[model samples]
Target chain A: MDLAPYLLLAGLEGLVQASVLMLTALGLSLVFGVMRVVNVAHGEFYMLGALIAWACGAYIPGPPVLGFVAGLLVAPLAVGALAWAADRAVLQKIGYNPEGTIVSTIGMLYILQQGALLTFGPDARAVDAPFYYTIRTPWFGYSSYKLFTVAVAILLVAGLWLLMRKSKVGLLMRATQFDRETALNFGIPVGKVYSAVFAIGAMMAAVAGVLVVPNQQAHYLMGTDPLLLSFVVVIVGGLGSIPGTIAAAVLIGLSDGLLSVFFSPTLAKIVSTLLVALVLIFRPEGLFTVKGRRA
Target chain B: MTKLQVEGLSAFYGQSQALRGLTLELSGGEVLCLLGRNGAGKTTALKAIMGTVPPSSGRLVLDGRELTGLPPQEIPRAGIGYVPQGRRLFTELTVWENLEIGLMTRKTGREALEHALELFPVLRERMQQRSGTLSGGEQTMLAMARAMCLNPSVIMLDEPTEGLMPSAIAGIREAVIRLRSEGVAILLVEQRVDAVLPVADRVAFMDHGEIKAELPIAEVRANPDLLHHYVGIAARPARPATC
Candidate 1:
C-alpha cells in the first residue's frame, strides 16, 4: 500500500466532498436562519439538479463542460423557482407554522422524488467529466479535472464569503435574517429577498450536483445521501453560521476520509453517524455555536 | 400640506378588529401625540398608517397619495418613516448596519446615511455594536434614528419610550421637538402623556381601537380629567398649601 498515493486521493476526494457539502448546506442554513424552517425538501432540490444534469447530458451535444454548466445553471434555477412558488403558494398560507412547514417540505420531497422517478427512469446514468484531460504531476498522481473541481470549490467559497461580507445585498440578507419586519421597515423589500435567497440557495445545491456528477454519476436518487450528510455537517457546524458550516464540513470530510482509509468505508459511516448522535446528545446547540440565533 | 391623513382607518387581527374607524390628520411640522393605555390601538394606528397592517376598508393619504393597502416597504418609499413598538431593531445587525439599511430601500446613497448619523451622532460612536446588546435606551435612540435615516416626510413612532429610564424618555422627547422644528410631521405613540404634552400640538386618546377624544395639548393638560377619563392616568394637580 503506497501511502503517498492514498493521501493524494483522500485529500482530493475530501476537498471535493467538502465543496458539495458546503453548497448543500447553504440553502438549508439560509432557510433555517431566516424562516426557522428545517426544509426537509432540500435533498429533493439536489435531486432535481442531478436529474436536470442527466437530462442535459442525454439531450445536449458537446464536451462535458456544456452539459455540466447547463445542469449546474438550469437545475438549481428551476428548483429555486419551484421553491419560490412553494413558499408563496403553500408555505406562506401556513404563515410560519413550524410543523406545517416541516410536513409540507417532507411532502415536497416525496413528490419531487416520485416525480423524478416518473420523468427519468430509476436507473443511474454515467455523467462524463466536464474536463477529461489528465495533468502530469510528480507526487499527486491525479487528473487535472479533479484538481479543477477542488479549485472551483475553493473559488466559490471565496466568492460566497466576499459577497456575504462586502456586498450591500449581503447586508440586507443578514439584516432580514435577524428580523424580517425591521428589514422591511428599512425598505429592504423583504419578500424579494426571500425569493432571491431561495433561488441562490437552490443554485448552490445544483452547482454541487454538477461538480460531483463526473464521479458519482446522475440518478433519480443520488441526492439522498448528500442531504443526510449535509444535515449532519450543518448541525455540527451550528445552524445558519457560514464559518460553522465550512468548519463542520471539513471536520466531517477529514474524519470520514481518515476512518474509511483506516478501516472499511461502511465502518466509517457507522462511526460518523454515532459521532453526530453523540454530539447532539452532548452539545445540543452544536459543536460550534454563537448562541444558535433561534432557528 | 398635510403629510399623513387617516380617514375611517380600521384594522383587524383575524376576527378581532384592532383599529375601528380611526381618523386623524397630520400636517408637516406638527407633533401629534397618541396617548392611551396599553392595547389602546395606538400602535395599531401607526402600523396601519405605515402600511404594516392592511386596513379592512379605510382611506390613508400621505402627501396627497392614497396609501390604503400598500405593503410596509412600499409605505416607506412613499415617504413614511416608522419606528415600531419594542424598538424592533435587527438584534443581530450592528447599529451602523441598521441605520444604513434605512436608506438602502431608497434610491438615495450614502448622503442620506451621513445626514441621519449627523443628526443622531451617538450612533456614529457605537456603529459596530450589535443592536441586541445595546441598552434599552440606546436601542430606542437607534430605532428612532434609523427611521429618521429614510428622510421621510412623516415620522411615526410606536412607543419610543417604552421600557426606558427617565433620561432616555426625555432625550426622545427632545429629539421629537427638534424633529418638529425641522418641519418633519411626527406621530408619537406614547403612554407618557406628560413627556409629550410640551411638544404635542394635539393629542388623540384611544380606547378599544377607536380615538375616544382629540384635543389640543393645552386642553388635555388643563383638563387632566380628559387624561383620567380616557387613559387612566391622572395628572397631579399641585395644590397650594393653606397658610
Candidate 2:
C-alpha cells in the first residue's frame, strides 16, 4: 500500500470538504456577527437549497447542464427570499432579541424540516453534475466536477471579501454591526440592512448546497451535518470574524477528511468535538481573531 | 430665520417622564447652548429632536418642515446632524470608515470629506487607524467631524468637550464657532458652561426638565446672580468675544 498516494487523496478530499465548509461557516458567522442571532434554522436553509437543486435537476426539461445551471441560479435566490421573509415577518417583529431568535429559529428549523418531509417526501435523491470529466493525477483519477466546486467556492469567497471591504453596502452593514443605534442615527436604514444580511447569509449556504448536491444525497435531514460542523467551525474560529471562520473551516475540514480516511468517521467526529472543547478552554475567542477592539 | 423649532416637546421613559413641555428654537447661523445639571433632561431634549427618544407630545420643525415622529434614520436626511454623548465612534472601524458612515443620508463626495478633514486635521492624520485607538479629544473631534460630513443645515452636539484637556476643549470651541460662521445652526448641550459660553449666542438654563431662563449671553453675563442661582456657579468674566 502506497501511503503517499493515500495521503495525497486525503489532502484533495480535504480541500473539497474545506471549500464547502467555508461557505456554510462563513454564512453562519456573518449572521451571528451582525444580527447577533443564533440561526438555529440555518441548516434548514442548506437542506432547502439541496432539495431545491434536486427538484430543478429532476424536473427542469433540459440537459444535465441546463438543469444544473437552473438549480445554481434558482436555489440561492429562492432560499434568500425565504430567509428575508422570515427576517421581516418573524425575527424583526420579535425585535431580534438574542434569546427569542434562538427559540424562533429552532421552531423554523422544525418547520422547514417537516415541510421538506411533507412536500419532497422522505426519500433521498441526487443531481447529476453538469459535466463529467476526470483529471488523471500520477497517483489516481479525480472528478473534474469536484475541482470545479473548489474553484467556484474560491471565486464566491473572493467576491464576498470585496463586497465587505469596498462596497458602500458593506460599509453600512459593518456600521450597523458595530453600533445599531448610531448607524440608525446616521440615516442608515438598519432594519433593511438586517434583512439584506440575513438574506445574503442564507444565499451563501444555499450556494454551497447547490454545489455539493451532485456528490451527496439530498435528503430532508441532510442539513444536520453541515449545521453541526459549521457551529464547530465558527466556535473554533471565533464568532463574527470572517477571516477566522475561513481559517477554522479549513483546519476542521482537513482534519475531518484526513482522520476519517486514516481512522474512522466516528473517530473524526470525536476528535473534532474534542478539539472544539480544547479551543474553548484555551482560546475561547477563537484562533484567528485580532486582539484589538471587541466587535 | 429659525432652522429648528421644538414646541411643547415631552418625552417619557416607560413610566417616568424625562422631558416636560420643553420648547426651544435655534436660528440659522446661531449657536444656542443648554446648561443644566445631570438628570435635568438636557440630553433628552437632544434625543427627542434626533428622534432617538419618542416624543410623547411635541412638534419639531426644521426649516418649516415637520419632523416630529419621524424615524431616527430619517431625521439625518431631513438636514440635522447629531453627535450623541460618549462620542459614539464605531470603535472597530477606521477613522475614514467612521466618517463615511456620517455621510450615510447625505449626497456628498470627497470634497465633503476634505472639508471635515480641514476642520479636524488630526482625523486626516489618523484616517487609517481604528477609532477606538484615538485619544478622548481625537474621538470627540472625529465624532464632530463625522457629523459635519453630513453637510447638515443644523447640527446638535451633546457634551462635545466632556472629559477633555483644555486644548481639546479649545479645539471643539473653535470648531463650533467656525460652524456657526458657516451658517449652520448649532444646538449645543453642555455641562461645561465656562468652555461653551463664549461660543453660545444665547443660553437657556434648564432645571427639572424645564427651561428656567432663556437670555442672550450678554444678558446672562450682566446678571452674575442669575447664573449663580440657575447654574450653581457664578458667571465668570466674559472672555474676549470672537465669532
Candidate 3:
C-alpha cells in the first residue's frame, strides 16, 4: 500500500475542510470580538445559505454557474439582512447581556432551524458544482472546485483583514470593541456598529455555507455539526482574536480530516473535544493573547 | 463667544440620585474647575452634560444649540469633548487611531490632528504604539490630545491629574491654559486644590449633588477654609508641615 497517495488525499480533504471552517469560525470570532455576543444561531445562518443555494439551483434559469453565482450573492445578503433585523429587534432590546444573549440566541437557533425545516423541507438537497473540471494526479483525480473553495476562502480572509486594518469603519469597530462607552463618547454610533458587526458575522458564515454546499448537501439538521465544530474552533482560537481563530480553524480542521481518514470519525471528535478541554484549562485567555489585547 | 450652559441637570443610577438640579456654565476662553469630594456628583454632572447618564429633567445648551435630549454619541459631534475619569483611551487601538476617532467625529482633517500632536510632542513618536501600553502620564497626554483633536468649543476633563506625577500635572495645566487662550471653554474636575488654583479662573464647589458655591480662584486662594468645607480636604501649605 502506497502511504503517499493516502496522505495526499487526506491533506487535500483537510484543506477543503479548513477553508470552509476558517470562514465559519472567523464569523463567530468577529461577532464575539466586537459585540461580545455569543450567537448560538450562527450555524442556522450557514444552514440558510446552503438551503438558499439549493432553492436557487431549482428556481433560477440558465447554467449551474448562474445559480452558483446567484447563490453566492443572494445567500449572504439575505442572511445578513435577517441577522441585522434580529439584532435590532431582539438582541438590542436585551442590551446584549451575556447570559441573555446566549439564551436568546439559542431561541433564535431553534426558530431558524424550524423555519429552514419548514421552508426547505426535511430533505437533504444536493447542489451541482459550478465547474466539472478535475485535476488528475498519477494515483487519483481531484475536483478543481474544492481547490476553488480554498482560494476563495483565502481571498475573503485577506479582504476582511484589509477592511479591519485599513478602513475607517474597521477602526470604529475596534474602538467599540476596546471600550464601548469611550467609543460612544467619541461619537461612534456603537449601537449601529453592533448591528453591522452582527450582520457581517452572519454573512461570513452564510458565504462559507454557500461555498461548502457543492461539496456536501443542504439539510436543516446539517447546521448542528458545523456549529459544534465552529464552537471548538472559536474557543480554541481565543474568545475574540481573529488571527487566533484562523490558526485554530486550520489546526483543528486538518487534524479532524486526517484523523477521520486514518482512524475513526468518533476518535477524531474525541481528540478535538480533549483539545478544547486542555485549552480551557491551560490558557483561558487563549493561545494567541498579547497583553490582553484581542489582536 | 461659545458657551455651555447645563441647567437643572439631574441624573440617577437606579434609585439613587447622582446629580440633583445641577446647574453650571462655562464661557469660551475660561476654565471652570468643578471641585468636590468623592460621590459629590461632579462626574455625574459632566456625564449628564455629555449625555451618557440620562438626565431626568435638565437642559444642556451649547452656544444656543439644545443638547438635552441628544444621544451620548451626538454630544461629541455637537462640539463637547469629554475626557472621562481614568483616561479611558481605546486600549486596543493605536495612539493615532484614538486621535483619529476624535478627528473623525468632528469631521476635521489632518490639520486638526497636527495641532493636537503639537501640544504633546512626545505623542508624535508613540502614535503607532498601542495607547494601553503607554505610561500613566503619556496616557493622560494622549487622552487630552484626543479630546483636543476635534477642536471643540467645550472640553471636559475629569480628574485628569489623579494619578500623574508633578511633571504630567504641569503638562495638563499648561494644556488647559493654552486651550483657554484659544477661546475654548473647559470644565476641569479635580479633587486637589493645588492642581486647580493655578489654571482655574473660577471654582465651583460641589457637595451633595449641587453646586454650593462658585467662587473666583482668588477668593478660594484667600479663604482656604472654603476648600476644607466642601471637598473635605484642607488646602496644603506651600511646604510640608513639620511634625
lDDT of 3 by residue, B98-151 (tens): 999999998988888888888899999998998989999999999999998888
Model 2 chain A worst lDDT window (10 residues): A286-295
User: lDDT tens digits, residues B1-243, model 2?
Assistant: 989999999999999999989998999999999988889889999888887888899899999999888888999988899999998999989998999887657876777788889989988789899999899999999999899889989999999989999888888889998899999999999887687668999999999888988999888778878777877887777665452
Docking class of 3: high
How many pairs collide in each candidate, listed in order?
A: 0, 0, 0
lDDT of 1: 0.80
Distance (Å) between predicted and true CA of A288, model 3?
Answer: 2.2
If you assessed candidate 2 against the hidden native complex, which CAPRI class would it receive? medium
Q: lDDT by residue for model 1 over A1-295, one digit each (tens)? A: 5787777677666676777777788667777776677888888788787778878877889877888788867877788788888877777788768899899888988888898889888899788877767666566556777667767777877887787777888888888888777777777787777767766676677777777777777788877888898888888888887778888888887777766776777886787788789879987677777773532
Model 3, A87: alpha-carbon shift in Å? Answer: 1.0
TM-score-wise, the better of 1 and 3 is 3
Per-candidate Cα lDDT values, in order, are 0.80, 0.90, 0.90
Q: By descending lDDT, how would the candidates be arranged? A: 3, 2, 1
Every model's TM-score:
0.90, 0.95, 0.97
**lDDT, model 1, position A272:** 70
Winner on lDDT between 1 and 2 is: 2
Model 1 chain B is weakest, by summed lDDT over 10 consecutive residues, at B234-243
